[model samples]
Target: MNTPPGLHLKIAEWMPENGEVVSAYDIAENFGITIRQSRAFLTILEKDNAIETRRGKVMPITCHNSHRRSTRTIKVISIDRDIIAQRRHHYNTYRHCPLKSINGLSRAEKWEFIIRNARRRKK
Candidate 1:
């Protein structure tokens, strides 16, 4: 059988800027992997010190500037400490808003937000 899907690239892509934090669901959808797959990948990455996840408030460095003005603070996984540090510097300069957890939001809800907001800008 073929080798299993490698999540290294996905993990790299999922890493947020210095001050951002992403949820497990975010990584799954972003990498087009299953939720379980994302979790498994994250477990491995955490061990490798490729990414960091923590309880409570992970800030978002980037945001959607649409009318809805919805923001997300996602946890990030980065290979280079400098990159994350630079992003943190940028955040200091730009002042990105810190992300807050929304109670009662399921994985599906988060996906809907991404899709809906993405579509809204296409028009």
Candidate 2:
């Protein structure tokens, strides 16, 4: 199915910088859509060759107010390589992370490293 141009533009704007991952929950919340709709939209993006996605493990959470619980599976989406390279260049030039070898680190670990190093540099 073809996504509307306006919605597509909004989705693109809401996407994380290339190389960063975004969850379907994040997309749904940002776009004021249901989780299922977000997934469908992402699938369309993938079909259109606009993004790449990896299925992540499901997590369970319970609401504080309600007795109901739910499981949510996160889909990690990444933008094009060229865009990721450009973003990495920008990070390297301005927000340099001291870690010389980020080769094997997981995405969360890399983000932690960047945040920790950036915070240390500020002090």
Best by lDDT: 2
Q: What TM-score does prediction 1 earn? A: 0.37
Model 2 C-alpha lDDT per residue in residues 59-84, reported as the tens digit of each score? 45454753435443433365575764
Span of 10 residues, lowest total lDDT, candidate 1: 65-74
RMSD of each: 19.6, 15.8
Q: What is the lDDT of residue 123 in candidate 1?
A: 44
Stretches off by above 4 angstroms in model 1 are: 1-6, 17-19, 49-74, 77-123
- Cα misplacement distance, residue 5 of candidate 1 (Å): 5.3
Task: Residues 20-118, candidate 1: write the lDDT tens digits.
Answer: 565556776766777556656656665545355443354343445433333233354346667555655675666666775656789998888768758
The runs of at least 3 residues in candidate 2 whose Cα sits more than 4 Å from the true structure, single-residue gaps closed, are 1-6, 18-20, 61-123
User: What's the distance in Å from true for residue 23, model 2?
Assistant: 2.9
What C-alpha lDDT does candidate 1 achieve relative to the native structure?
Answer: 0.55
